[model samples]
Target: MDTEFELFDDDKSDVNAPPSYHAVSMSSISADSVQCEPSFVFSKAQTKQIRTTVLSLIRGMVITPDFILSSVGPTLDACATSLPAAEFTDILQESNIEGHTPLYWAIVNKRPEVLSAFHKFITAYKNDSFHDVRLACMVTNDHTLFTKLSLTSARLHKMERTLNLSLGCADEIQVYEGDTENQFTAKMQITMFQTRIRVVQKLRMEFIAQGRIWGLLFHVGDDTRWEASIYLSKHSLPARPKALLTVEAQNEQHQVLKKEFKLKEGCFLAASEYTNFSIRTCTSTSASLGSWPIFNDTIYMDSNGTLHAKLDVALQ
Candidate 1:
């Protein structure tokens, strides 16, 4: 935000005033007699080039405020998942040039993606071992964001907090029931301590049709795992709770890069249960738990698009 202007001394009058010019005939002033100091000035083209160079340099810096504000998704994703726990805490605690924490900056700019990524990122930090809870709590702009951050406080970092600190999506997966695509989602929660850590993730199945259900499990566990499962109700068939489902991994464009598989994967629920099928095992080798990318939004298709699911599989 620096301005390219010169400050005048006391000897000069009205430094802020616009320049005044007196109308004079061209012949009145002789070019040879009038002498003036030559100032270094760039031409229009040169000025534009200079501006472009400066902007490019600014963009190259890792912690520039402009870059952070514009691309919070990628920025926060990198910080949250890749950085060491201490370094991540340092960034959250540090303030930008405008005297605002990164979290506050994201809040002021309404970067929900950044906030969400941060929430996912801090899930890896050891519970009760937090050292920067104060910095996160100081943000008062967004009450919702503040509430989420408050849940990270050391004093409140307990089993209840563990349940509250879940990292998953609401209604992330959906299945069409008789032409209506009903929703399903899995929530992954992490609990950490000074000496021991425990993690629990669950996928809830609420709606079903013809005793068939399809869903994706993102980051089922470490190594960037993803799973696609199909389940059938025990009552749908005469005896066995098992069913057959074909699963395949599709790219963003829905192009199948991985082949399909037919497997015996299905669970049964009685009338007491809300949905009939709630199987957790993936039916394909491609979708099984392995080393997948963190930002992988790859879609896992069942029966070639009859049912689909995807999730942000970020590493803490």
Candidate 2:
């Protein structure tokens, strides 16, 4: 009974769902809408043109953040606009003959201001070079820079698919915040990750939202298939009437899969203190494990066997 595990101090849900607990059909689980056309292929000359323009953008010895944000990003955007979405995304992730990408150079050069400038540029298409650029960030040894870029990468992935490859939680933990015009969207990330293997594992990540204390407790051990259980120390304020909880992770194919829980009705019972609301059970929801989930038993692991999980609660 840790006082700081305050979010769900009163939660008493079990690892196994009770007969009274209704397991909603997994209908909402599906791929995010992405229209991929096979016909959008780039010509050899066009690919070379894009690369040449990009390499020239960063050719100068001293690169300024302002130049990168204004000139480089816009120029890159124009290139992407001219091509099909799939082809443009693929080229954005490519390197020049020198074996380096614009992203890799931008980060390695330490132009901190220019990182988030590409947020829009990266998210507009399906770019999968996040983790690769992160490996290049290590040379700077700037944890703050590392953290900012880590968040930028997560934001680019937009919640469902996220990976944080910073040195460790040893440095200050970074929080990614989002809220709607209506209620609130409280997000949590297992910045630390692992792969599916026949072994027991455990981890913890603590974060703050609007000056309140919160945490995610994780346990990885599988009875049948590889399984994991993630528990948030608490839920939204008892005042909020209902909530929708969403959790997700990437798969072998790099597609982000999402599963949600509606915390209302019999599922989310509320009372004066902090009744047995559905969101709490959803929070206490036993993780299915792997690139994981109760959503699907698949987890995204880096070259090293670490797992990454993303959870967010929208109060309604």
Candidate 3:
């Protein structure tokens, strides 16, 4: 039988207290209190203790009411406050041996407060720029969790809402939400292909692969053209300096069309420079196409306006 997870005692309803780390001076902080004082000191032992404590809580807690949900955010925040910035980030980003991280569980469980708390912690920790966990897509270990995830992960992956376009809008930008698979691939499905046949001068969708940020850009004109480019020093760099990019889209009447481009550091576009960007930047491949999309949809998009396409890269 499943039991409700308790975060604190009845007397401290508003306080989020995880197990003690046996520090020099430990105090129970209110769940509603702001982050701890900067002058507060944390020992390495305390950091390690809280890390184990939080992971245990994440595994044991089951969703039931908003009270439990509400308590978790502050509990995580308090645990975070006990660690130094780098250790805090490493825990937030590290996965267990099972190939899942605390954030992954929070996301799969559909805990907005947990995600929201993480967003705050990350932003505060890395104030210079925003940081997000680099996940290709959500994955779960068991059938029950997988079934639960299927219902909640849609907003982050598939396209479901209505999209409208005006005919021949110049350099008009529309971002097709991408779905990910193939370990390091992102699929861009353009819904409303009928509209693309008319408008769709340019379209783009972005996803992360192999810890690097990437985007698929499409230009439909006298001919259709697509480019797969990786973001530069902007985020994390690709493990390899070069890669072979494969693009698959649909030709007229849903025929599969495939193309490949060799990308290296020399292929970088110098125009993408931005201040404070980290290292050597983006590489790209663009080619004119006779048609649109190549996902299973060149095999899945209906006779309606949807066209599906995919691009994958080989780490060479």
Best by lDDT: 3
**What is the Å distance of residue 72 in model 3 from its true position?**
2.7
TM-score-based ranking: 3, 2, 1
The top-ranked prediction according to TM-score is: 3
lDDT of 2 by residue, 1-316 (tens): 1111111111453233111111211121111111212223656674454444433433321133234344445444544455465655555456531344545555666654455544555664334365436434433433345455442332342222222322343224544545553333444444334421222244444443332223344455555543333233232333222333344334454665444433434343222234443454334434343434323344444334334445554444
lDDT of each: 0.32, 0.39, 0.42
lDDT of 1 by residue, 1-316 (tens): 1112222222453543222111222122223211112212545564343333322221222223333445445434433333345555645544421343444434444455555555554544443223222232322212233334442232243543445345322222222222223222222221121012113232322222332222222225444354433332221221122222233344555553332324334522222223324443332222453333222242542322222322222111
Clashes per model (N, Cα, C within 3 A): 0, 17, 9
Residue-by-residue lDDT tens digits, candidate 3, 1-316: 1111323233543233333222212233333222444424545575455556654444333222333665666566666665567666666655531344545546546665665565565533221111222231212222222222221111232232113323321221122222433334445555564454344344554444443445455555343343334332233333342333333333455545565544455334222433324545344455555443433244435565455555555454
Task: Give the Cα RMSD of candidate 1.
Answer: 21.9
Clashing pairs in 1: none
Give per-model TM-scores: 0.23, 0.34, 0.40
Error of 2 at 4 (Å): 44
| Cα lDDT, model 1, residue 175 | 27
* Candidate 3 global CA lDDT score: 0.42
Off by over 4 Å in 2: 1-51, 58-70, 124-128, 151-316
Query: In terms of lDDT, which candidate is stronger, 2 or 3?
Result: 3
Consecutive 10-residue window with the lowest summed lDDT within model 2: 24-33
